[model samples]
Target: MMAMTFSPKFRRVSGAASGESTVRRMALVAGGAAILALGAVGGYRLVAQVEGDRGIAPLANSEDIQVNGIKVDVTAKTGAEARLEGWKLAQKEAWKKLGGPDMPVEAIDAMVSSVVIGQEQVGPRRYIATLGVIFNKARAGQYVGAGGATIRSAPMLVLPVLYSGGVQQVFEVRGPWQRAWAEFQASQSPIDYVRPVGAGGESLILTAGQASRRSRLWWRNVLNQFDAASVLIPYARLERQWPGGPIHGTFTARYGPDNTFLGTFEMDAGSEQELAGMLDKAVQRMDGLYRDALAAGELRPDPTLTTSGQVLDRAFAELRTKLMPKGGAPIEALPQEIVLPSSTPSPVSTAPAETVSVQFASPDAAAVDAALAAVRGVPGVRGAATMSLAVGGTSVMRVTVEGGSERLASALRGQGWKVTSGGGALRITR
Candidate 1:
């Protein structure tokens, strides 16, 4: 009985049959792995397609228009021919969509810059595609009757803030509103816009929150940095009916250091395919609103920036009293006497021969004039001119003084200017 007993390991069927079964099992495993790998790749592609747009860059003299869902059926020698014809048809449609419906074929050909394919399908004798067409700005503007309005506006900084799906963002992320502004043809618009391309730290500082800041000093500094006279906040709130459904966009035009509300408009798109065009139209309408405001003189630069000799005189008189010696005595009777040097005035020098550099915080033109008058009001200061004028920031002025930089510092200090001496310069700030 012991000899008849067999271990389970050795009680198998024929070896060839075992090998065939093992091979079949391996085949099944490989097939499943292949299917899973294919599925993973397809899923990744689908996700990428869903979030595909990295946003079209702003073209200097071009306008982009989308021609969606163009289908063509024709008997051709090859599928490639059919696709090419379909693209041509789509491009023609794009021209029509851009208000060039009555344009001549030759004119369309001259105006078209390039065509980009979005989605395409090819069959034996049929083709379907979504095409993006870029048109020349100069030509397109003429066709759309846009260049007629003369834009004489001062440069204005633009902060496009988007509120979408319970999130508020500016240039922190690439949003559809930001993209629309980027792609907008500002040159054709009646509003002179100073649009930042959302680069580096500058964009983070200039945001939606900054728009609400009522501090004129802060706004002046920001405007000076960008060389803009004022700021524009174009806000957009998007509400979607459902995923991939109609989008309702509410756009509001706001401006100035005090975020004044200019106007608002409501727009909608049937689907995502039409969203970009809807946004483009919205931007144009916003520009038109700004144009109206500008015509009404509501978009003028800050009046506080005005400078005059009277302002300078008033500032100097105030500073003169502050810097004057106690008991109406001369500067020589002061605790620190600013003695004039004996150097003869050079022929090339218009006023005092010696020049002392004075740096001060000039938050506005008034501050600049005040600083200049304060320097010129000094006993031995013959003349003062701004060497570097950075309104809303630190400015440097070269003063033709009869004495040295130390005396200039003392004079500023006497006038209640917090003077810091560094690098042979007198730095003063209120």
Candidate 2:
């Protein structure tokens, strides 16, 4: 290191110079010094740039990666850790969160795999896993799209969103088996709910009037932590052979709530006490169901068994069927979206009485425009609008002829529009 010195050429003249002149000279000196400092900095920067250019060299070699694949070094020891066994537990939770109502735990586990931890070493070591999470996507999509529309839909709740295939790739791509296991454990269904989504608990644990409000409370509690949308449950039919003999049972299950069937479960002596307890549980189950579902002056069951005779004494024919047809239950994979409130009406009429939806083949804008014009000319046809065009979905143009909707459809048919009339209206062929 060396010391630098500066001569006081712009020195304070003190009493010799007037105060104003002295201040002005000091400022000029300071400004000059600043300019010199800036010049020195600029020169240093230029030199640094030149050195950097000279020092720059070709990059070193490294492992290669392919799409949907990445490079990683794996050690045999990390793959066989006992903690990894717990990973399945985490998978179960993730599955439960994913499964929603009464989805089979084993099915979920079987579908979603917790692959072993792997590692890669270039200079440092890392962990990784390839987890496969299989689910019923179509149903899931519906549930995701249609969650939270009705009072019954309160059970539909979705949790645990795995955006990737569990193998997150970054910094040598890794996922910890232990951490994965912890996450699996962290995920849980509404275990506290008597009947979780899809009424899973009732099918597994309760019998008789198990479809009561009390039982549903258990489901409500379990699903309480979850946002209402994530849960997706489906209604199903079961041919159950209990101690009382075979009963063709049917119930609607909220996703992950309780009623998912995982193969067969034996009631043996193992679950007897619990089974007996269900007698009272059944009564408790309906605690608020009847009151909640009742209309003005409608007959309702009391949780305290006040209306047992009324419930049981009902005409045999009437007692059997309530919500759905006998031997015909709504069978669909879960995550069936609770249909959201839609201002946009479906072009295809599902309502049996109000309107008819007819589609016209329109390959392009011109074709669609022509179809619209043709529809306008038809008698009784009030209005025609382009439902969808060019887009892959419902590319057919829809013309909703308004005058006595049914008559309009008939009139369109006479105009040679290929049409199928149903759902309270007609679908003009596209």
Candidate 3:
């Protein structure tokens, strides 16, 4: 009789240890929920307008990738040794795909941000896996001879609208197109992408149709709510060659307040199995196209949308001065204006009410109504209006109030809502 010894490593290990002392293993595949949850912890968040909640901020420089069909075998005294070697081989291949060529093995290991296991098969002494790898941008770029710094453009909101199955939608339901954008790491590109998760009412307003809206005034208001300078509408029309067949996607890159057509590209997925990866690739290409347009000065933000508020303020000041006299007849009848005993109120000019966009998770119709009512019921809330509504997700409401977000959040807290403040927006989830 022969005895096999198996010992588990305390640090990091996955899968069941079999009778053999040797082990083969695999890692780095994540679903949309898992990826989004990761972002919730450390990713930069921007409150969505209609779909208010935490949104994944652009990675600024990171990349998400999958290294598939990894099959490697190593002869070692132990199965753990063989498994570790297989992972090393897979990481090396992924690094090469990321543009790191001829780099030292030790250096490549340091650039790996994370690894997730998608598929793994363990034989007596063999291992196979489909791994997902996220590379640290700064380190990977250095090894690949790519630029290290990101030249970010003015912030532009991303509305990834998909046309599929004879319907057009943006966050109305779960779609691969929107998921691809959410999972994308756009740090290396010149364009600063402001992507919303579209949890609620935001999706209702920031839709495919919004790309065609030419009113700078409307754009200005929308941009103000999201703190975006302009908008990018990356439209994808998916055409299935046949049922359960290849998917051909026609993508167009449009930008600016007017949604000017920049360019279009076509990509295809061999089958439904390839659709997700194909969409991810298309996003990267779309980002590259945007970067190219920016380099050529073709993607400039509309000044009308960005500076229009200041222009309006100045015009209003002029109008007020002309329509309303600041001085009372210059005291023409008196030699000297008698000063009152009261302290001279230094021109008591009223500050304009700050518009605060409040986002809350509404899991049902009742919750939505409750949130809207709670917002309106808050003291100092001048008015509240729904900007976007997702019946069972996050919703964004614009609140005109006397004080800023602090005041609104304080009030919501009183109502037993968990409020988190970020980037001048409030997210209330209960």
Global CA lDDT computed for model 3: 0.71
Candidate order by decreasing TM-score: 3, 1, 2
Task: Give all candidates' CA lDDT scores.
Answer: 0.72, 0.35, 0.71
C-alpha lDDT (0 to 100) for residue 260 of candidate 2: 37
Per-residue lDDT of model 3, residues 55-165, tens digit only: 333334345333434445554545676667777887887877766678777877877777766566655666666666666655665566455565678778999889999
Each prediction's TM-score versus the true structure: 0.51, 0.23, 0.54
lDDT of 1 by residue, 299-352 (tens): 876633222223344565566666655687655655554543324332221233
Candidate 1 wrong stretches, greater than 4 Å: 1-57, 61-79, 86-107, 116-149, 270-274, 305-430
**Mind giving the per-residue lDDT tens digits that candidate 2 earns over 1-430?**
2233445653544654665576677678778888898999899976553242111111221111101112233333445442343344444444454435555656544444233332222222323433323334343343222345322222233221111232311112111211121122111221211222212221222222222234544543333233121232222232334554433322232333333321212122223223222222222222222223222222221211211122333443243334234565443422346322223322332233223455555556566555655665664343344545663334544443434566666666787777675665455653
Better of 1 and 2 by lDDT: 1
Show model 2 residue runs off by greater than 4 Å.
1-76, 79-90, 96-106, 111-134, 137-353, 363-365, 372-401, 406-430
